[model samples]
Every structure is written in C-alpha cells, then in structure tokens.
Target: MVSKEKLNRINELSKKSKEEGLNTAEKEEQHELRTEYLKVFRERFKKKLDSIEIVDDETGNNT
Candidate 1:
C-alpha cells in the first residue's frame, strides 16, 4: 500500500501527462495539415520547372 501523499502525487503526474499527450497530438495534427498545404503548392511549382534544363548539384551533371 502506498502513502496518501505518494498516491496523490502519482495521480497528479498521470493527469499532467494525459494533458501533455493531448497537446502534443494536436500539434502533430497541425503540422500534418501545414505539410499538406505546402504539397499543393509544390505540385503547382513542378509544372513550371518541366521546361527548364535540370542539373544535378551534387555531381554537376545534367539530370
């Protein structure tokens, strides 16, 4: 059996962790939404590059 204060502390930490987990999940969802928004713009930008000559920066060769 645990002491009353120890048990209370454990309970408090549990609640705190639960709240933190929810906050982290919310942030992750927001990040994913921002990534998807960028993806839409990236696709549009790719169309403009198709006609330009592509070069590989790593090897200094045409890709």
Candidate 2:
C-alpha cells in the first residue's frame, strides 16, 4: 500500500495543479507518486483475480 503521506502529497499536488500549476520538481514528484500508486494497485488487483475460484454449478467442480 502507498503510504498515507504520499497519498496526501498526491492529492495536494493534484489540487495545486488544477488551481494554479506545478513547478518541474513538483510535477516529477506527482508523476512518481502516481506511478507507485498504480503499480501497487495493479499488483493487488492481479492477486485478487488470481485467487478467484470459478465453479460449475451442475457438476460442483472448479473451472
């Protein structure tokens, strides 16, 4: 999971972006934070999908 502080920073940067604009460093930071967040999210989602067990109702077998 992304740290709470990083998430907060991401939000702050986003709001700042919409309100005014970001300096180059801030833009880079935001990109890195977002990339990390997406990477973690995709990993968790893939794990959840891998754990899913589908069964055939009639035969009571896993598919």
Candidate 3:
C-alpha cells in the first residue's frame, strides 16, 4: 500500500491540476507518485491472484 502521506499528496495534486494547474515539478512528482502507487497495486493484485486456487467441480479437483 502507498503511504498515507503520498496518497494525500496525489489527491492534492489532482485537485490542484483541475483548479489552478501544476508547475513542472509538481507534475513530475505526481507522475512518480502515481507510478509507485500503480506498481504497489499491481504487485498486491498479482499476489492475491497467485494465492487463489481453481477447483474443478466435476472431478472434485483443485488446480
């Protein structure tokens, strides 16, 4: 999970973008934060998928 502070910053940046817009540095920071957030999210999702077991109903088997 992304840190709470970073998440808050991401939200702040988004709101600023819609309202007054961001400077170059803020835009870069937002991009980096979003990339990190997506990376963590994707990793966690993959871990959840890996932990799932598929079962075959007809044969009473698990794969």
Candidate 4:
C-alpha cells in the first residue's frame, strides 16, 4: 500500500499536471489563431471547457 506521504505527493503532482495541461492547451490554441488555423474552433473549444463545472465527479466539489 502507498504511504500517506506518497499519496499526498501524487495528488499534488496530479493537480499540477492538470493545470499545466490547460496552460499548454491555451498556448497551442493561441498559436493556431496566429497562424489562421481555425481560430474560431480553438476559441470555441476552450470556451466550452472553461464553462465546465470544476467538480470531482465522486465528491461533487472542486478537485
């Protein structure tokens, strides 16, 4: 079984990964817009995801 300390570290890393992923995605979309590669699509997709309720499914609260 994972130790509590290790579990907490894993959870922290997971949260960081999610935030990093979102940042990278935003940058990529920005580049796509600059290059005229469906800027509207990129913006729309990001907008939809931004509107998502940031809740853990099981806990029904923020992660």
Compare candidates 2 and 4 on TM-score and give the better one. 2
- My TM-score estimates for the predictions, one after another, are 0.38, 0.94, 0.91, 0.34
**Any runs in candidate 3 off by more than 4 Å, and if so which?**
none
Tens digit per residue, CA lDDT, model 1, 34-61: 4655676687688767767888999889
lDDT of all the models against the reference? 0.60, 0.99, 0.98, 0.58
lDDT of 3 by residue, 3-36 (tens): 9999999999999999999999999999999999
Report how far off residue 5 is in candidate 1 (Å): 48
Candidate 1, which segments miss by more than 4 Å at Cα?
Answer: 1-22, 51-63
Top-lDDT candidate index: 2
Model 2 CA deviation exceeding 4 Å by range: none
- What's the distance in Å from true for residue 32, model 4? 12
Q: What is the per-residue lDDT of model 2 for residues 1-63, given as tens digits with 9 covering 90 to 100?
A: 999999999999999999999999999999999999999999999999999999999999999
TM-score of 1: 0.38
Better of 2 and 3 by TM-score: 2
Alpha-carbon deviation at 16 in model 2, angstroms: 0.6
Model 4 weakest lDDT span, ten residues long: 29-38
